[model samples]
Target: MYNLAKYQKLKNKINRIERAELGFFPTQIYKLENLSARYGVNIYLKRDDLSGFSTFGGNKIRKLEFLFGEILEQGAQNIFTYGATQSNHALQTAIACRRYNLNPILYLVDVIGEGIKDPKANILLDKVLGAEIKIIEFKENEDEFEAMYRAKAESKNYAQEISESEDDYYLIPPGGASPLGTLGFVNAYLEMKAQEFKEDLNFKNVFHATGTGGTLGGLTAANKFINDDIQVHGINVSHKDDSYLKEVAELSTAALNLLGIDFKLSDRDIIVDNNYVGAGYEIPSTRANRAVKIFAEDEGIFLDPVYTGKAAAGMIDYLEKGKIEKGSDLLFWHTGGTNALFAEKKILGNLLDNHI
Candidate 1:
């Protein structure tokens, strides 16, 4: 437990930051009774999945609260962002942009095929929202991040070609994984802390999927701010190395700075495991597929094949290896992306059970 005075100070500081009202605040946390029994640990889920501004609720809503707040604050006329074709961040940005009457333009890097034109899950929703999109194809050996960088570079060229004024547009990184966006997760950490106190909750560890590292940043910042020692495990849904770990730490530190909190994050504060990224991002793996099935059967909760599925699989892996002590309290932060279930069949590779 942390000092109440310090806790209040941290909470107050976070509240001072500007954020657009986006999702429902303090989304519920509940014990996974049957899953606890099956896995031999006290399991709980922090449901960022049901973070509803719309029924299409997701973890991105939290980040968008701060992101859109900053974007709209600047009075930008056009919102430009980057992500994969079925990018949840891009879709949510479209929604937020429409809500404020600002036009949305997307520069999407294709993780699968040409995602922007594919008209699937998020891409389809992007179309419905009338977002202008540019699909960034992988040229030869260029990876996703490389493609993302190139996409950002091309965004300017595209903007100039379209004759959109530079001041009229704002470019957000993929996954809303910016320092400002990271503040959302920092807010989430505060929410969870409040929940922990109210219920006498004791989570020795917290697990979540990490993509562009925004959520990871927030979770780490929260723990640091409160001086809590929770072992927050970031299970990679895509390939990430030690450099990514350092970047996440840096991002968290930057986020704390935004809140007027003085804190420097180090490698010790960031924990990430890159082993669970099935085949790759947007490519569902057999292990992740089974994970989706088990969570559905046991908790009746749907985890998307792309992000949360891989995270659940990694948590289960640690459980199997006895890396986590028996009977210890563990919390899985459900950073939602269930939209992928309705995405292309490739993303839903293992969601189809033989019985069903």
Candidate 2:
């Protein structure tokens, strides 16, 4: 129920932003003929994985586009954000901050070991991007981590330490899921929707991993603006609880409001299935590994076990179970986290052992 005139106007603004060349290009969308034929459904991949720029480009970069734009518009000199030890969002935030010549300070929670030997591959990129890292123990209260980081960013002494003035912007939780930030993914959806007509195909369901929820939320809200029939399914790769669901809904509502789209979305619109995550966020599940191998073997596509693999597994499960009707076009979004594959070498040791 989004206003078409306002949606078109928002799409125009997004197109202007795209002309700036802030991130990579259209990141291909090719049909997965084998998988489609096997499953008796039309399947395509929106390869955000190919979003170029130091391997940091992915769905998160789309979100960072608007976030960094706001930071620059505010005349901020430094950027602050927090995440786990190896956060792709944090790494990409550092990259965008560098492009804008703004200093980035990353607060990592429960991080172990410095400089290499970290189980997360983004650690190396974090250092390479020259983002100042602070480790925090979050066992007691998670709010302390945010309070301490925000205080540090606001401190005159800390501002001098990063060689910045008191006027700087700090990004709140999970790559700025605010309405302003979600504009990036909303534009991305517009891009895909344009491609839909050119490809002569109609997509029914769009699936992606819901981690911090920004990508899925923005995409879902934008979908309502573009095509109401397009349903976005967010496969939760993190803990599936009420809090996470609420976060997704809130972000989606913000996104809708940002574009001046008056759309009423219920809980049913936000579909999050959390049956796949085996352990924690970075841990790999057995089903995800199998999905990775199957995709590699069948489509010659490599997927990271943490995000894309689990998402693909959920998509496949939905396909096999009749949830996704036959001939209903399915688009699986590849949010790149492939670097996490090499970070956890022990888990992949058996695959290499065969050749060794």
Using TM-score, give the best candidate's number: 1
Model 1 Cα displacement at 342 (Å)? 1.2
* lDDT computed for candidate 1: 0.86
| Residue lDDT tens for model 2, 1-356 | 33567567767756554222357767789999889898999999999987857656778777777776667767787677767666777788888888878888877664332324453578778887788887655444445336446444544345566545555655545655677677777787878876887988788889888787888788877776554578788888766676676767777877767655576555556778888876756566777777787688779988887788889889888888889889878899998878767665533433333221
Q: In model 2, which runs have C-alpha deviations exceeding 4 angstroms?
A: 1-7, 13-21, 111-120, 140-166, 346-356
Q: Tell me the whole-model lDDT of each prediction, alpha carbons only.
A: 0.86, 0.72
Count of backbone collisions within predicted model 1:
0
Candidate 1 on 230-300: residue-level lDDT in tens? 88899998887788978999999999888787889987778999889977999988888888898999989
**Pairs that collide, model 2:** none
State TM-scores per candidate.
0.95, 0.85
True lDDT of residue 341, candidate 2: 72
